[model samples]
Target: MLTQDIRQSAPVTPTQAGTVATLMIEEETTISDAPLFVPEDIGAGLLLLGLLLSPKPPKER
Candidate 1:
């Protein structure tokens, strides 16, 4: 478990909260002509599925 002193670092003030909120709103309003998603090869998915289906090794003592 973590100690108490490590958890008492600086907390955000109201002023900082307002600034962060403003920045977030500004970012949301901006739009880009860039593509949102890129298409991947079918083989890539197969490779990942193969890895997930493979059996794991026995746990070490």
Candidate 2:
């Protein structure tokens, strides 16, 4: 198989001491690009839904 040949050609070796690998990721976003609904928005929506769906007390005669 191709994988078997690759493995045989380049054998795996343990990392050497004092060796460090650094991975840096950079993301760029503009102010115009914003999420439609954030956590606070979802929480507020749930709270409003609960208030609207809650039972109401009876009125006095």
* C-alpha TM-scores of all predictions: 0.29, 0.30
Q: How many clashes in candidate 1?
A: 0
Q: Give residue 43's error in model 1 in angstroms.
A: 73
What digit string (tens of lDDT, one per residue) describes model 1 on residues 1-61?
8766656758899999999999877755566688756556577998899899989988999
Best candidate per lDDT, number? Answer: 1
Q: Where is model 2 poorest over a 10-residue stretch in terms of lDDT? A: 16-25
Q: Of the candidates shown, which would achieve the greatest TM-score relative to the real structure?
A: 2
lDDT scores in order: 0.82, 0.62
lDDT of 2 by residue, 1-61 (tens): 4555443455334452223221233345556865576678589889999999999988899
Clashing pairs in 1: none
